[model samples]
Target: MAKPWFRVKRFGYGAGLPCAWQGWVVLAAHLALLIAASALLTGRPLPLSIVVITSTLGVVWIAWKTSDAPWRWRDGGED
Candidate 1:
């Protein structure tokens, strides 16, 4: 029989590695900020323009910096 807490612990949200998760989290935060900035600046719904520009820059930055392969990346899936 498996312990109840074990299941909960193993199945916890965002089971991936910390470093990998950190990168994703940072990216998400940056995107959200840009989206919010656009919405606030443009005073329009969705704010896709800022999202696009911010996304482009974010992606490029990640892609270039991550190419070294030294960056710690958490697994997308739980162990």
Candidate 2:
């Protein structure tokens, strides 16, 4: 078993939202942000958009961390 902090069920909601289902909503939001950012960045050359690159990196990191955490499906969605 993994620590609660390392669990995917614990990844989605925090501070403001506490429900496990909220996590899925948050995850989807992040995915959408990533897609939008990527589309915007594609219009410009890499060298001209450091901000987009940084933002994309941050988004990727969040997405990666969320997915990396073990989703405790056995818990039926609870952490």
For model 1 the TM-score comes to 0.38
| Predicted structure 2: lDDT | 0.47
Q: lDDT at 51 for candidate 2?
A: 59
Worst lDDT 10-window in candidate 1: 1-10
Per-residue C-alpha lDDT of model 1 across residues 48-71, encoded as one tens digit per residue: 665667677876565444432323
TM-score of 2: 0.35
> Considering every candidate listed, which one attains the maximal lDDT?
1
Against the reference, the lDDT scores of all candidates come to: 0.49, 0.47
Which 10-residue window of candidate 2 scores lowest in summed lDDT?
1-10
Candidate 1: residue 70 lDDT (0-100)? 29
The clash tally of candidate 1 reads: 1
